[model samples]
Target: MSTTLANQQRSKIISLLSPAYLWLTVAIFLPLSAMLYFSFLSDVPFGQTEWHLTTENYQAFFQTTTYAKLLWKSIKLGLIVTGFAVLVGFPCAYVLAKVIQGRAREALFLLVILPFWSNSLVRIFSWAIVLRGNGVLEIGLNAILPFEVDVNLMFSTPAIVIGLVHSYLPYVILTSYLALQAIDDNLIDAARSMGAGKHTILWRIILPLSLPGLLAGAVLIFVPVVGSFMEPRILGGRVGTYFGTVIEDQFVAVFNWPLGAALSFILLAVVLVILALSSPILRRAQT
Candidate 1:
């Protein structure tokens, strides 16, 4: 009787979870497995083409310094973009969560995330027009100032960073707003009644509870930015050749599928390591 009951419970659990597990297998695990399998091959598997297992694809990354340098450049870009997003989005989130209320907060929230509804490619191209020499930004600055200004941000690293910040800023704002809003008003009031100053309250009570969300948003921003190529290509031009662009070249222009797969696997490993390192702190904060 006990065994039968246990078996029935197991079957019920599997029935509930089967659909999601099946979707994960079909959508994610299979593709990743295929990529890993292909990464070990010497050549692409096509009709009449000879292919064999080899580790040269990964070795290319180690033998040459270029890949490492480009990867470092990408990581640096992620950090810079994440920093800018946090700095610019935090105050907006605070206002939305604490300062504003009622219908005004809802409207402001909608306005803050309005850019997310637009096509990302369109937005990047629009920035290109605005950042070009003698463009809107240049014209505006020159019009206001006595001295003529040349704003040639186009085809530069800063341009890429700006586009990325514009694209991902809302993630931080949304995450931080959720975190800040979850705090109890009475806790803040008690802090105030206990003679805690504004800075002290913010530093001690607010920042601690909200840190988890900030980290979550930062992780979200950093991970995709590390893998980004399109925005950098469109905005950074000559300076856009980072790790992701190199991987893109391997798959698109170079047609080295195995090498690209290997590079992608390496990047996945790096991202996993970053998340693993941060998970402890995030877990502690949540607790």
Candidate 2:
């Protein structure tokens, strides 16, 4: 009877998880498998297009230095955006989680997430309007200061960074807030009672405790930023060509789906390797 009951419980657990597993298989795995298959093909096997299984798509990446440089550039962009997001978002999160309270906290929290309420395109264009030469930012700066200012950040790397950061900063703030919320106030009090300075406590206790959330936010920001084409294309102009834009061109402009798939898989592999290398730190943080 006990053995039968255990079997029934296992069956119930599997039943509960079946729908989610089915959705993942259909949505994620199936598309990834299709892409993987496409990456090994000479061309898209549709309509009158004659195609064959080939490794040239993958080989092309290693054969060209241009792809490597663009990929590295994208990786750098990801790191920069993630670093800025964490630096800015963490303080905002700390204030929200540990300092503020009641209605004021709610109001501020809403403001932090206010960007999400509007379309991203609107936000990027708004920044463009502000950052353009003789635009709001320059004019406003000139109005307040004695010195004349000329600010034109649009169509530049900084503009891309700003837009990406604005778009993704909330992820860092939200995750960091959740992690910071879990930290006990008593521990802080205990540290204070033991004569720990603000810096000491922050470095020795708070930072270590909140690392998982930081890493989680970093991953969330880094992964998307690396593959982002739209923001860079709009904000960066000629300077914005990265691995993502190259992949986009391969699909949209060049109609080279197999090459795009190969590039996409290479990006996936790079991301997986990064995650694997960092998993030990993530596990340590959770413990």
Question: How do the predictions measure up, each by TM-score?
Answer: 0.91, 0.94
Question: Residue 235 error for model 1, in Å?
Answer: 0.8
Query: Over the stretch 1-116, how does candidate 1's per-residue lDDT look in tens digits?
Result: 99999999999999999999999999999999999999999999988899999999999999989999999999999999999999999888988998999999989989889889
Lowest lDDT block of 10, candidate 1: 278-287
How well does candidate 1 score on lDDT at residue 169? 97
Candidate 2, superposed: residue stretches over 4 Å from native: 281-287
All candidates' lDDT scores? 0.93, 0.93
Estimate the TM-score for candidate 2. Answer: 0.94
- Say which candidate scores most in TM-score: 2
Candidate 2 RMSD to the real structure: 1.7
| Whole-model alpha-carbon lDDT for candidate 2 | 0.93
